[model samples]
Target: MRIEHLAFNVTAPFEMADWYVAHLGMQIVKRGETGCFLSDKSGMLLELYEDAAAPALDGFSFPPATFHLAFAVDEVENLLRALVKGGGRQEGTLRTLPSGDRLAFVRDPWGFPLQLVSRAGATP
Candidate 1:
């Protein structure tokens, strides 16, 4: 079976949905008062749940040891610039792998780590 969707407990679901749409080119598949579902052109889905009571866990403040989401882009540097322009923060420097792939890490508006990688010859 293939992966369906990744869920995030965010403080502002609608804002997060808009951020993804504006920056990552995701579209809203469904929206509700407490949550929203978004999908990319390839049908990859993301679920965002609004949890006002959710504990604040900024990467720098709390340091989450959990998983991070990685997205493949045509160019890592361009995506990094887009992410910063869209209000996301670049956490670290961009690195090039020995395989000639580039990787950059950034934190979403709500502080979730996201890896942007060059999709030169990589397959889904």
Candidate 2:
């Protein structure tokens, strides 16, 4: 089966949800007091849950670093420019992989890392 949903522990899910919807064009498909489920036009989900007041997972109080969520873009340049206009900071310059894929990074207001990528040979 394919991966369906992913969740990130966040400070304020409502505010963060709004930011994702605005910045990445994801839609708020569902929301609750402490969590939200967001979806793209294709119906993929990205969930966010409140966790600041809760104890750490596995007794570690550090931030989550297992993996980061990436938002693929048809045009990395346009996405980066829009993110910059929306107050997000560019993490680094676009890099072309040996396989010819292009990728770049940016950071959200709350410091979550996001990647924008275009597959090799795809029209930008």
Candidate 3:
């Protein structure tokens, strides 16, 4: 079967969803009372679910750390600047690989790690 979408738990679904839309230019494919479904111009989907019950997904959890999500980006610098301006913290520096691809790790306002990736030869 083909992978359809990814759903992530966050404290504020709308706020985090809008932040992604604003930063990465993804469209809001669908909106619900508890979360939002987002897709890029190519239609890859991500779901943001509001879960106030628990925020941390450390090793002491069920979902586990391997379930983390990442969003593709064109230019990591601009996105990092925008996120910083909007109160998001930089979890790590620009991690550049030998292939010319780069990635920047950042945490949303609610403390969820959001990975922004840019591959080699990718247009941003």
Clashes (backbone N, CA, C under 3 Å), per candidate, total: 0, 0, 1
Candidate 2 per-residue lDDT, tens place, 44-98, comes to 8988888776742231232323334677678888888998888777776888889
Question: Which of the numbered candidates is closest to the native, going by highest lDDT?
Answer: 1
What lDDT score goes with residue 122 in model 3?
A: 77
Clashing residue pairs, backbone N/CA/C < 3 A, model 2: none
Poorly placed runs, candidate 1 (over 4 Å): 52-66
Model 3 CA deviation exceeding 4 Å by range: 51-67
Candidate 2 stretches with Cα past 4 Å from truth are: 52-66, 122-124
- lDDT against the true structure, per candidate, is 0.81, 0.76, 0.75
TM-score of candidate 2 against the unseen true structure: 0.81
Best to worst by TM-score, what's the order? 1, 2, 3
lDDT of 2 at 72: 67
Sorting all predicted structures by lDDT, with the top scorer first, yields: 1, 2, 3
- Superposition TM-score, candidate 1 onto the true structure: 0.84
The collision pairs in model 3 are 74-124
lDDT of candidate model 2 versus the reference: 0.76
* lDDT digits (tens) for residues 22-117 of candidate 1: 898889999988889999888988998867687633444533225567888888888899899888888768989888888888888888888888
